[model samples]
Target: MATKEPSFEEQLAQLQQIVNQLEQGNTPLEEALEQFQTGIKLAKSLQNKLTSAEKTLGHLIDDAGNERVYENNTDDPSNNGGGNRGFGSGDSVKG
Candidate 1:
């Protein structure tokens, strides 16, 4: 059976342990190399997760509790709702 992939926290914890072990300099060269590779993979996975989260969090919401994606143009006149608009801003900002 295939092994389950670790969650983000688990992966981060494993990566930390790997770093600690490698830093101790007690592992044999070959074993240390393998740990290093594993750590790199974990790091990449964590990074990708973080990137995905940032994109998700960056999504702007409209006044009616609807999600509105931010476009490349920050100065778009259509989006000028001041600080009261988007995300968790109060209902007063609703257009």
Candidate 2:
């Protein structure tokens, strides 16, 4: 039998626990180093998951039921070409 992989939430919680342990300043140097490395790996895995989700959400279905890449309407008067100012630019999602 194979071991089941932890879900994203479980991995995030484990990373938080590791951070708390490191912050308490009670663990020995070697243990602390090990936890720190594990935390880095978990963080990277979480980031990759988020990026993949964002890409998936970049697709949309129109009224005609045609699948198309989502496009931010920067030309709208209210948008003022700053629709994606804070988040990543719309061009980041390529079809």
Candidate 3:
């Protein structure tokens, strides 16, 4: 099945609409419960998509158009906190 490609705003709006409809309190108990389940699924799917997208796109950039990629050197014996990880005030930046 093809998942809908909805922007964050659009998904949020749909979620709100579902909430509003459920909140009106006029639907039958069975229908209300079904709507609630659908809303929960929508919320979970939206959350997961947003989180994955964030992780995929998360990054730091410099004024010189350099991408900052940080690698932990904890396993290296030379890295003993003797410096500030060579990152500060854009002087010693990442990447």
- For model 2, residues 1-95, the per-residue Cα lDDT tens digits are 99998999999999999999999999999999999999999999998897677556767889999988775534354544345664455556658
**Model 1: pairs clashing at backbone N, Cα or C within 3 Å:** none
Query: 1 or 3: which has the higher lDDT?
Result: 1
Ranking by TM-score: 2, 1, 3
Q: Candidate 1's residue-wise lDDT over 28-61, tens digit each? A: 9999999999999999999999767756765798
lDDT order, best first, reads 2, 1, 3
Winner on TM-score between 1 and 2 is 2
Per-residue lDDT of candidate 3, residues 1-95 (tens digit):
99978887887888899899998999899998988998898899898887566444545677999877433323334544233455452475459
Q: Please identify model 2 stretches exceeding 4 Å from their true place.
A: 63-65, 72-95
**What RMSD does model 1 have?**
9.7
lDDT of each: 0.81, 0.82, 0.72
Worst 10 residues of 1 by lDDT: 72-81
Residue-level error in angstroms, candidate 2, position 69: 1.8
Best by lDDT: 2
For each candidate in turn, the TM-score is: 0.65, 0.69, 0.53
| Runs off by more than 4 Å, candidate 1 | 1-3, 63-66, 69-95
